[model samples]
Target: MTNVLILGAHGQIARLATSQLLQETDHHLRLFLRQPERLTITDQAREEVVDGDVLDSAALTKAMAGIDVVYANLGNAKIEAQAKSVVAAMTKAGVKRLIWISTLGIYDEVPGAFGQWNHQMLDGGYLETYAAAAKVIEQSGLAYTIIRPAWLSNADTVSYELTQKGEPFKGTEVSRKSIADLVVKLINDPQQHIGESLGVNQPGTDGDKPSFY
Candidate 1:
């Protein structure tokens, strides 16, 4: 069974992905979170939780040991530093695959009215930080898949179409569940999405704008 490390394990999307992974795959889960006490999972059969800040490389390396794939659901702010730490830890631990979650408008990939609003809402240091993190992953010489979802929602179900880099954002909003599902799929089939940065959103819906606005 594949051994996967999940960063920010207590976050909503990460929690959903953890649940799905436990149900759908035989993979072993290593959960890296700042606050491990917040996670309330009854099943302890195939899961290990490590409490540590994302910026702590030694801690991350300790948690990442023997891990084959890493799912990064870290938030913004010091995301660039966190990504650097993760890359360093993964390299030291020989973990070659990473599925990282970024957001729309990081590279101005979204277009038209929604794109404009996205820029307005997510602009400034955070966007730059995410972009820097993306660049680090792109140049890390490791197999990586960057999943950038549009404005996120707490919808209950999973359903969305993913567009690769250079395509317009599919829609203004995608359920967190959908993003989680996609992350899980990528984890299960790492070879298909390696070195690709994808944009995900609910499909076939027009005239709806980015949820940030």
Candidate 2:
């Protein structure tokens, strides 16, 4: 059975992916949540919870043990540092596959008015940090798939589109469910998108900004 380690286990996308994995597969999981008490999961079944900072190398090493794929569904400003820590731990653990969640502006891939507004809102801040982290993962020599989702929504829908790296990022929003669906797909087929950075969004949702904004 493939063992998967999910960092930032408390994140929305991570939670959704975890739920789907629990329901659809019997693979073993190691969930890393900074606040263990915040995790409401009562069933341990084939999963183990690790409570600590994602930047804690010791803790990360322990979590990565015997894991085949690493899903880093993290957010926050220190994301670059966390990515570095994960890379170091994965190297030590000799794991190859890494699916890291990033955002659209990292590559300035979002075009037109939206891109301008996104940069004005995020550029030098979140985008810079996310891009740095992506650089780390891309240079880590690991089999990695960096997933960059457009403005996220909590909509209870699964429809979405994919734009490979180099393609203009499309759409203004994507559902959290859609993101999790992609996560589940990559987990089931870890080799399907090795070395690819994908942009996911809802078809026809493109505009200057997300509807909620």
Measured by lDDT, the strongest candidate is: 2
Per-candidate TM vs. native? 0.95, 0.97
**What C-alpha lDDT values do all the predictions have?**
0.86, 0.91
Instruction: Report the number of the highest-TM-score candidate.
Output: 2
Model 2 residue runs over 4 Å out of place are none
What shift in Å separates residue 204 of candidate 2 from its native position after superposition?
A: 1.1
Write candidate 1's Cα lDDT for 116-163 as tens digits. Answer: 777777788877889889999888988999999878888787879888
Task: Please write out the lDDT profile of model 2 over residues 1-213, one tens digit for every residue.
Answer: 679999988899999999999888878888888777777775587879898888889988888888999999987889889889989999998999999999997888899999998898887678999999999999999999999999999999999999998899999899999999999999998888899999999999989999999
Q: Report the C-alpha displacement of residue 126, candidate 2, in angstroms.
A: 0.9
Candidate 1 clashes between residue pairs 3 or more apart in a chain or in different chains: none
